[model samples]
Target: MTRVQANLLLLLAAAIWGGGFVAQSTAMKELSPFWFIGLRFAVATAAVLPFVLLERRKAAVKTSRRHLGLYLAIGLALFGGAATQQVGLQTTSVTNSSFITGLYVVFVPVIAVLFLRRPPHWIIWPGAVMAIAGIYLLSGGHLSALTVGDGLTVICAGFWAIQITLAGTTVKETGRPLALSATQFAITSLLALIVAAIFEPVSLDAIMGAAPEILYVGVFSSGVAFVLQIIGQRYTTPSQAAIFLSSEALFGSSLAALILGETIPPVGYIGCALMFSAMLVVEVVPELSRRRAQAV
Candidate 1:
C-alpha cells in the first residue's frame, strides 16, 4: 500500500480505539480490569480466527518456533499497555488518561533511535513537540494535577510504543503478519486470563452483563484495529505511525465530548488545530523533501 493509504489505515485504527475507550470504561462498571481485558481479548482471538485460516489457505501462512519469544514479547507488551490503561482509567479522568497515554508519540522516536538504531526523519522531532503540546492543551491545559492513575497511564504509553515498534519490525522479519497477530492476541488473552484468575473475580453473569462492550472492544479495537496497525506499519515508519496513532487522544476527547456531553474549552480548539498540523507535518515534510531532492 502507499504511504497515504497506510497512514489513513492507522488513522482509522486510532479512531476505532478512541471509540472503544467508551466501551472499555463502561465495562468497568460490571467487570474487573483483568477480567474485562481477558474476555475482550478472548473475543478478539475468536474474531480473528477466520482471517487466520483464510490467510493460511491463500498465502500459506507460516511461523517459526524460533520467533515464539518475539511474539510472546509483543503480546506481553500489549497486555501491559492495555491492563495499565484500564486500571488507570479507574482512578484517572478520561482526559488525563488520553493525554498521558499520548506520550508514546514522543517515546516512539526516542526508543527507535536509542535501541532500534533507526533515526526518524528530522521533521518527527518538531511534529512530536507540536503534538505533545496539543495533547497538554487538549487535556485541559495543565499537567500539575496528576494522580497515581495518571502515572500508570504514562507507563502504559511506554509499553504501547514498544508494542508498536516490535510489531512493525517483527512483521517484516517473520513474514507472517496474520499469524503473528493471531499469536499475540492469543498470548495476550492467556496472560490476561491468568492474571484475572488470580486477582479478579470472574463470573458468568458479569461477563454477560458487559457482553456488548466486551465484544465491541474485542472485535473492532483488538482484532480489526490491531491488524490494520500491522498492515499500516509495513508501509510507513514507526515514527510516522506513532504520530497518526496518537490522534486517538484527539478522537477520544472529541468522541467523549459528543457522547458524554463533556465540554471542550475554547483553547481546546487551538490544541486540535496544532495536533492536526502535527499530523500534516509528518505527512507533508517527507513529500516536500523528496520533491526538493528531485528538483535538485
Candidate 2:
C-alpha cells in the first residue's frame, strides 16, 4: 500500500477502464444508451453487493439516513457522467470518448480550486494544457471533427471529477467503502432504469444482444476498477491519482487499435506523448525532488 504500489494499481485500473470503452461502444450497437447503462450498473451492483455484505459482517459498519443521502448524491453524479458518456459514445469513436473523458484529470484540479477552495499546485495548469493538446491529437487532430458528443463527454469529465472528489472526501467518514460503492451502483442502476423507461427502448432482446459487453463493463470496469480506485487512492494523493488514472486514454487508444481495428493518426500519437509528458512533469518531478531532498 505504498504510494508506488497504489500508483501501479491505479495504472492497472486505468488499463481495465481503457479496454472498457471498446465494450461500451460495441454494446451501444445493440443496445440503447440507457439500457446499456442500466444493465451494466445492475450487474455491477450485484457483483459488489456480496463483498459489501461480507465487509459489513466483519466490521461494525453503521449506516445512517445522512450517510444514505450522501451516497445518493454521489450516485446521481456518477450516473450522470456514465449516461452522458454512453450517449456520446453512440456518435463518437472510442478514442474520442476516452480522450475526452480523460479530461477529468484537468477538471478535478479546477473543480478543487473553484468549488472546494483548494489551491492547486503550479504544475496543474501546464499539465492540463498538455492533456488538452493530447486530447485534440487523440481525436485525430482536426477540431472540426468535434461534435456534440465531444461536448457531452467534456461535461461528463467534469461530473466525474466532482464524483471522484466527493468520493475521496466521504471515504474516510464511511467505514465501508465497498458497501458505499454498492449503494452508489444500486442508486445509479435505479436512476438509469428510470431514464431507460422514459427515453430508451429497453427490451429483453437488446439486453441479451449486449449481454457479453455489458458483463465485461459491469464486472471489470464498474465493479473491479472502482474498488481498485478507492483502495489505490487511499494510499495516493488526488492529483497523483488523477495522473495515474489519466493513462486510461492512452491504454484505451492502443487497445482500440488492436482489438477494434481502430487507428490513430501519427499526430494523435504525438499528442498522447505530449499529454503523458505533462502528467509526468506534474507527478514524477515532485517525487524526484522529495527523493533528492531525502538523499541530502
Candidate 3:
C-alpha cells in the first residue's frame, strides 16, 4: 500500500478506538475492568484466530523464537495500556482519559528517536507538541478534574508508545500482521482472564450485561483496528502513524458529547482545530519540503 493509504488505515483505527472509549466507560457499570478486558480480548482472539491460521498456511516461513518474543512484548504492552486505561476510565471522564492517552503521540516519536534510533522529520516534534496541547483542549479545560484514573491513563500512554513502536518493527520484519494480532490478542486475553479470575468478580451475568461493549471493542477495536495498525505501520513510520492515531482524542471527545451527553467547552472546538492542523502539517510538510528542494 502507498503511504497515503497506510495513513488512512491508521486514521480509521483511531476512529474505531475513539468509539471504544465510550464502550469501555459504559461497560464498567456492569463489569469490572479486568473482567471487561479479559472477555473483550478473548473475543478479539477468537475473531482473529481464523485469519492468522490462514495467513500461516499461505506463508511457508515458520515462526521464529525472536518473533514470538517480540509478539509477547507487544502483547504485554497492550495489556498494560488496556488495563490502565480501563481502570482509569472508572474514575475519569472519557474525554479526560482520551486526552491523556493521546500523550502517546509524543512518546512514540521520543521512543523512536531515543531507543530505536529512528529520527522523524523535524515537523514531528512540533506537531506532537501541538497535538498534546489540542488534546488538552479537548478535555474542555477540565484537566483539573483529573483523578487517579487520569494518572493511570498517563502511564497507559507510555505503554501504548511501547506497543506501537514494537508492533511497527515486528510487522515490518515478519510481514505477518494477522499472526501478530492473534498472538497479542490471545496473550492479553489470557493475562486479563487470569487477573479477572483472581481479583475481580467474573460472573456470567456481568459478562452478559456488558456483552454489547465486549463485542464492539473486541471485534472492532482490538481485532480490526489493531490489525489495521500493524498493516498500516508496515508502510509508514511509527512517528507518523502516531500522529494519525492520536486523533482518537478528537473523535473520542466528540463521541462522548453526543452519546454520553458530556459537554464540550468552547475551547474544546479550538482543540479540535489544532488537532486537525497538526495531522495535516505532519502529513504534508515533509512532502512539500522535498518537492520544493527538488525544484531548487
TM-scores, all models, native as reference: 0.82, 0.87, 0.83
Model 2 residue runs over 4 Å out of place are 1-11, 58-61, 229-244, 279-296
Off by over 4 Å in 1: 1-14, 58-62, 226-247, 268-284, 287-296
Ranking by lDDT: 3, 2, 1
Model 2 earns a TM-score of 0.87
What does candidate 1's lDDT look like per residue over 258-278, in tens digits? 776666567767766676677
Candidate 1 — worst ten consecutive residues by lDDT sum? 57-66
Is candidate 2 or 3 superior in TM-score? 2
Question: How far is 285's C-alpha from truth in model 2 (Å)?
Answer: 4.7
**What is candidate 3's lDDT per residue for 1-296, written digit by digit as tens?**
99999999999999999999999999999999999998999899998988888888787567799999999999999999999999999887887777778767557767888888987879897888787777677667677744788789979989998998999899778878788888888888899989988998767888899999999999999788977887898898755785788788878888998999977578977876776677567666777787779999
What shift in Å separates residue 192 of candidate 2 from its native position after superposition? 1.1
The digit string of per-residue lDDT tens for model 2 on 1-296 reads 69999999999999999999999989987999888888899999999988887888876647778788889888989998998899998777787777778667667778889878998767788888888888777667888867878878988988898887887677667777888788888888899989889987667887889999999999999888988987898899766886788789888878888888987687877877876676566665556667779999
Answer with 1 or 2, whichever has the higher TM-score: 2
Candidate 3 residue runs with Cα over 4 Å from true position: 1-14, 135-143, 226-247, 279-296
The candidate that achieves the highest lDDT relative to the unseen native structure: 3
Error of 1 at 109 (Å): 2.2
